[model samples]
Target: MLRADNLTKKYGDFTALNGLDLSVNEGDIFCLLGANGAGKSTTINLFLNFIEPTDGQASINAMDVTLHDRETKQLLSYIPENLMLYPHLTGLENLDFFCGLGGKSHTQDQLESLLRESGLQADFIHRRVSSYSKGMRQKVGIALACAREASVLLLDEPTSGLDPKASNEFSELLLTMKKRGVATLMATHDLFRAKDTGTHIGIMKEGVLVEQFASEEVSFRDLEKLYLQHMHN
Candidate 1:
């Protein structure tokens, strides 16, 4: 559902992403592990069409993102490190508003149901988003995906500031979407979350994808050792 083909992005003398070739199929949660400036967010932005690729392409469901920006965007949802919502709006209102932007409409009951399924607490649905923790805001993003029936999810550092429990909750929500055949490409620094939540893990360094493997192939300790080795090189 997501693909990057020799995707390269450069700014003058600097190459932010270097010939990245990747694919995330239906029901696959592909987590990207890398240090800062390793091109993780660059990959996500290329897919989102937030920035144009210098060479090659990023596509969703066979539609080239730059060539068919609107159509490809309709097939995916993006959750950045810090999700932004109107502080005065309730979670339900924010969900409804964003859904409307995507040309999706849901009744109140359906909207509430979606939020609940995304793991939002029932009592907080009507409360102002200003009071929500980072995890709660992310749940709304998931709800938006459900409402839109998005086939792909692009997440960048999505679990960064959350407590372990909240991060785990977010991972559970991703698993739920995975079961429904949504493809996910996440950029994260957390090795444990990547191992526990990802079906596949990739390590990138200096704009190159240096390692890729099935998550079950390595234990947590080995993954850490491998990641550190790459970082130190």
Candidate 2:
């Protein structure tokens, strides 16, 4: 449901991404691993149409994102490092409002159920978002995806600051989404999460994809060694 064909992005003479070719089919979780300035976020932004690509194409469900911005956006959900919701609004209210923007309407009970399924505690659902923790806010993002019945999920550093337990919870939610045939494209620095949660993995260095493989093809220790090898070189 997601594809990038020789995707390239540049700022002045510096290329932020170079010849990135990738595909994430329905029911697939593709994790991108890279250090800072490795073009992971640039790839996400291009798919989001947040910035126009300097060359090549980024598409969703075979439709070029740049050409079908509105329609493509309707088919996908994005969760950045920090999800921004109205601090004054309760979690349920935030979910409802975002779902409404996507043309999805649900009863209050249904909305509450969505949050519950996303792993938000029932008591906290009605509480103001300002009182919630980072993990709680991210569960709302998951709920938003479920409510919209989104076909694609684009996540940038979604687990960056979460504690191990919270990050594990988020990964479990993603696994549930995968069972529902949601294609996920996530850019993260967490190797263990990427290996444990992803079906496919790619490593990027200096804006180029240096290695790509199936998660089950290697041990976590080997993956770490390989990643470290690249970083050190």
Candidate 3:
């Protein structure tokens, strides 16, 4: 579970995020829809403790992230827009290394199984990451999340560059995580994908959360119209 209570962040005269209140519970995929500088990444950074909040709190599983940085980190996994992995290492090798950083040790078979469950092909699991497409790298990232048993996942622009097929594949993978009780908070520009995969959708503009609703309550066209209205306002 993830919660942000009146979270605020400011950089000198510029307010990056202001009074953000959000919650993502188990089995929830919350998608944040916003353009550049809409405070989406700032919200995530605050939750990750990558940057401290200027006001209020960012919590994971009811523990304040600022007060329990290490413990909160142990309960979550993050995937940024650009997933960085050891390019020369095989997918399995990368999974093991990242998982190890989280103090998770897995055998070759166990690691491979995680990758497979993350929607990776067995043939590519042993291949070096340098030869992988972005989608492949992201699958390994998901595997690392599973290997760590992360209960919360924070994703920022995860489907930015993937083709439709790969994007859909990634969406399916997220549904799998949801079924396993992983709460997900994702910042994405793909409205269609958000509608397809998110349980809740929020529109943010100029550092404020302007609109939010259950995905099924609004059609995709309605969501897009509301999003554009907020962006223009």
Cα lDDT computed for each candidate against the true fold = 0.95, 0.96, 0.93
For all predicted structures, in order, the TM-scores are 0.98, 0.99, 0.98
Writing each residue's lDDT as its tens digit, candidate 3 over 1-233 gives 79999999999989999999999999999999999999999988999999999998999999999999999999999999989899889999999888988888889999999899888888999999999999988888888888899999999999999989988999998998999999999999999999999999999988999888999999999998999888887
What TM-score does prediction 2 earn?
0.99
Tens-digit per-residue lDDT, 1-233, candidate 2: 99999999999999999999999999999999999999999999999999999999999999999999999999999999988899999999999999999999999999999999989999999999999999999999999999999999999999999999999999999999999999999999999999999999999999999999989998999999999999999
Q: After superposing candidate 3 on the true structure, give the runs of residues whose Cα lies further than 4 Å from its correct spot.
A: none
Query: Model 1 — which ten-residue stretch has the worst lDDT?
Result: 164-173
Look at candidate 1 and give me any clashing residue pairs: none
Off by over 4 Å in 2: none
